[model samples]
Target: MELFGQSGNFVLINIVSGNIDFDLRDDNPAPCENIWVGNSSTAPTDGECI
Candidate 1:
């Protein structure tokens, strides 16, 4: 489905691992900053964005 945020737009799909794979795009594309997304049950320890 289409996902919109303050950063940009994205398309997310479900994966076998019960995780979402998102393809993000932006008008002014640049390196993503501190973005992290994952299942709440298993989050990043270092606060690093995936």
Candidate 2:
């Protein structure tokens, strides 16, 4: 379980809606969603879809 990201502000939401919730602290980076959505080679990020 590992996510790579730079230091900044981000908003996490459940795309399906009302199924999941996410909150990432400034000290803790978020995992890239690329593993679940895009191809395994793309390396998705929390900011990609936005």
Per-model C-alpha RMSD: 9.0, 11.0
Residues 1-50, candidate 1: write the lDDT tens digits. Answer: 21234443332342223334333222332354424344232321222133
lDDT of 2 by residue, 1-50 (tens): 22355434334343432223322112333443332332222222233333
**TM-score of each predicted structure versus truth:** 0.18, 0.16
- CA lDDT of every candidate: 0.31, 0.31
| lDDT computed for candidate 2 | 0.31
What candidate 2 gets wrong by more than 4 Å, as runs, is 12-17, 20-50
User: What is the C-alpha RMSD, rounded to one decimal, of candidate 2?
Assistant: 11.0
Clashing pairs in 2: none
Candidate 1 Cα deviation (angstroms), residue 2: 9.1
